[model samples]
Target: MGEHPRRRADAQRNRDRLVAAASAVIAEAGPEASLEEVARRAGVGSATLHRHFSSRAELLEAVLHDRVRTLCALADELLTAPGAGTALVTWLRAVVAHAATTRGLGPALTGYASDPRFSPHTMIREAARQLLARAHREGSVAPNATVDDVLRLANGISLAVDSLADATECADALITLVTDGLLRRPANG
Candidate 1:
């Protein structure tokens, strides 16, 4: 069933405002940030926020969806970068940078159990699979390390360093740590 034209337009506008507001609030204060503040910032009433999101969990999920779409696009960009190791590291850096930008996103995305048909987790796994496969083929990553392992490691780094003052530094350290752990040592000359 289709809605009246005006009603559909209003709904679309509301969705845009809600998404913008949620992104702002979530970036500022994490997923647990105030819903009312989001509504207020969006220049809409709390009732309207609830009308659009229905609940805090729903808003959080939507914000995550928005972020994942951007992140996956970045992963696509990394696919064309030179060197599998460089591309993998570049992707990891980008992922961590994104995680730092969106407070609580790492945890929210990791915990949300959306259906695979619409699940960002599944998309994320596919992205990881591509990069990890390439890194393995290039002999820069461990042969036994699965996409799931890389994701878990990345998620753990994001969660652990989420609140640090120097999250970028922490993320770099974690990435280097993981990379060193995963790479094989060169034979002595």
Candidate 2:
């Protein structure tokens, strides 16, 4: 019994290491980074990598899922922040930053768009939706602003800068454009 539990723990550790390695390799070389590199980085054999992740997509999913969870948690926490619009803007910027820094992330994460139960795409949308809803209630942003709009904007920014040198910094500035629609003010001054 103890041996079985130990094996399970070891397997879990291997999975964690694989995920971590995949994340780093992907971030460095883009989504098309070699699987062999991942296994080597993880200090695991190719067979072990295959055992943990059948395909590159699955491994990417795990990485994106891990990051998405943290992003969602941040969105939830920001709900109580003083400025709803600013909080939403802040979260969106972070989302864009993640996308820009993590090359190929947009496509990798969007691959699960149809998964009803647990999709990184769905998770991010729902998180943004929550923040957008609060912004709507507070009349802090444009009434027509949707989570789709924000996400699309983020994706576009990510793509535009994917080949650029200072992509992350570029993404940070470009994300501010999204606030134009979300935080627009009346001209009744």
Clashing pairs in 2: 141-182
For candidate 1, write residues 133-155 as lDDT tens digits.
Answer: 88888897778888888887787
TM-score of each: 0.71, 0.76
Could you tell me the lDDT of residue 125 within candidate 1?
82
Off by over 4 Å in 1: 1-10, 101-116, 139-145, 176-189
lDDT leader:
2
- C-alpha local distance difference test of each model: 0.79, 0.83
The backbone clash count of each candidate, in order, is 0, 1
Overall local distance difference test of candidate 2: 0.83
